[model samples]
Target: MSVQPDLFDRSLFRIRRHRALKAAKPGADFLLRAVAVDLEERLLLINRTFGTAVDLGGHTGLVTQAIVNAGKAGRVLRADLQVADPNLPLPDLVCDDALLPLGDQSVDLIVSALTLQFVNDLPGTLIQIRRALAPDGFFLATLPGAGTLTELRDSLTRAELEIRGGAAARVLPFADTRDLGSLLQRAGFALPVTDLDTITVRYDTMFALLNDLRAMGATSILKDRSRTPISRRVLFRAAELYAENHSDPDGRIRATFALVTLSGWAPHESQQKPLRPGSAKASLAEALGAKEQKL
Candidate 1:
């Protein structure tokens, strides 16, 4: 069988994220910080405190600070695809997403913030995370869902097709919330729960939105993207199309970012488990006294 092509270039993505962090623009990482805040809130809901934890792909260490502030962990190690600065306040460890550096069942908690979506092998990454977590250990995270950046993707594709007679994959295909639970289960997580929330931010123009994406190190790193730089004419036309189709009453363009928050625990006997098939004692037909029809 032919090997499948990678959806993203992991090396390029790491470099872009490092570049964005180096730029250090004010409010450029507002989205990442926002997700970290939300993740911290969710972590607060868990009653247990972890002894040792790792924040995988923790860019700029915002989530690490959140974990520390909440007293969620006795020790939190920060890991990322690229080590942008070793002198940062947090203790940092450089590692790849698919293969974590920790030993099996060595961590009590594993939290990721605005990461995982960029991984070329998401399923493998989750499996590795599961292996790193001790029994009953928790996993919490917020990542971009399939609906994220839909407007921009549409606008760009339309512009490319019109200007260059074709469209390349310009946006990463983020995982859908519907598939999250299944993936967690497949990765050996217990009591996995997933939900999505949409955040719509309005911008004066498409250029502003694009600028924010670049500053956030979120520009497309699709492996099969066109080697040539984006032409100015194409960008202008895409901006025009975005405004025409996605503009609100105030003349501001609306960008929808659907974030999927996932929570799961490593399997342990103490954790609750679903009953076996055919274990239920009652049926709806009996409770409601409804007539049963056979197919």
Candidate 2:
């Protein structure tokens, strides 16, 4: 069956609003800083070969600044779903979604950090990335992986069940390492690789962690959510449960950030080719027999 194009869900606006509110917080700033550094490194590597690069989801122009400072790329395009501020220093800022606004084979490299997880049609976005890249170009991205924010999720689940007889909306959704690799391959990227890194952070309270998420523009995008405001009683109970169960002896709540980095190249005709079936000199069973004999 042919896949359908995934539309941007309106429910994500709520999550974005919460994250925008939290962006000024220290923890959120720290996380974005680290992500920006990673993006800068990727851009530098790509710049070694290509003169033009694009930074998708370049919020506030941090990565754009890094690219400009590297002085390798002749032109850097900073694009995002929305332009939160028009006064950012980025020279080529464009406000558009990832799947649109880019032309085929127009860019040398496409770098996106901490952006793909919010996309409902991740495969489509990747395909678009491939289309936007020049021949033999590179695409690099970083996204939250499974196991991120588990502490917050667990605490919220427990509190909601105790108070309202069910769980609250899921705050985040992330792809696993293997699945991300498959996605890159499915999107027609060559030499796809995915690596996972875990970052553990301690917060003074669960509320602090939530605030950071809000600042980072990371939140739930549930479509059928209740419009009623969250009650203070529920919030306090959730905090108490989180502190009691998920806190360390130092009285800090813990949260894990699972970062996944993916890199791939646009396919080229000069690259090595895969062997056809029955092309190998030895069969798998023969190879196993040889190994057994060696033992």
Candidate 3:
């Protein structure tokens, strides 16, 4: 199937707006900094063969700087859909889609943090990353996994259905671990691995969480829906439902963020390959029949 390039462009705009508004919020920045630190630690384990590194969806060059600080200054590149801040010290900052910017086998490492969930063609993007990497290159990414924001989503759904007779907009599209691993493999990355980490954040009220999402530029992007402003009645009702069901005994509402980290390597000819169909000595059905007869 063909990929939609426009969706990525739109997502970039949303992300840009989100970062701009929430730039001063220390809590969100703290979470992202932790992730960036973890990514740097993982990069250190790689053999130094990867002289050149490219960061996909590198919004503010945090991860890119991490790579540079690891002693790869001249070879690090940061790519994003929007024009990156020119002042952020980086070797290269290109305004382009992750799916089709870098050259074939030109980069040794491609890292994306909390960026893949908004991408509609994740497998296609992975394929592009694979193509951009030299043999033995690595692709590392972090995305929101399923179960993120369950409390907010469920409360919104229940309240919207009760008040407006329909569902509200979905906040995000997160992938499961199995599907993520398969996608990496299908994209020609070898030794695919995925692991999940759950983070639960407490908010004094549901409205506080909602405002944080807005400041973070996490509004729904459903184009077909009406752009009319949400009514105060609906908002209050939603908050009530959220507090009743999503709040803890201490009165703080909880929001869950499930981070799924993925890693894969570019394939090499030296790797083992499965035997071709009809090349095996015996079929599974034949082996089963023989075993039954012996029994």
Candidate that scores best on lDDT:
1
Off by over 4 Å in 3: 1-24, 47-49, 69-74, 86-91, 270-295
Off by over 4 Å in 1: 281-295
**Residue-level lDDT tens digits of model 2 in 7-119:** 44544664474348434454466776787787676666643666688878766677777767766577888875554433355446544544457789989877777777877
Compared with the true structure, all predictions reach lDDT values of: 0.86, 0.75, 0.74
* Tens-place lDDT digits, model 1, residues 1-295: 9876788887898788888878877888789888888888888888889999888877778888889977889998888666544336544688877678889999999888787888777788888888888999988888999989999999999999999999888788888897987899899888889999999999999999889999888999899888988889989999999999999988999999999998889899998778999999987788899986677
Per-model RMSD to reference: 2.2, 3.8, 4.3
Better of 2 and 3 by lDDT: 2
Best model per TM-score: 1
Q: How well does each candidate superpose onto the true structure, as a TM-score?
A: 0.93, 0.85, 0.82
* lDDT assessment of candidate 2: 0.75
Error of 3 at 3 (Å): 8.1
Q: Which candidate would rank higher by TM-score, 1 or 3?
A: 1
Residue pairs clashing, model 2: 19-214, 19-217, 22-215, 23-215
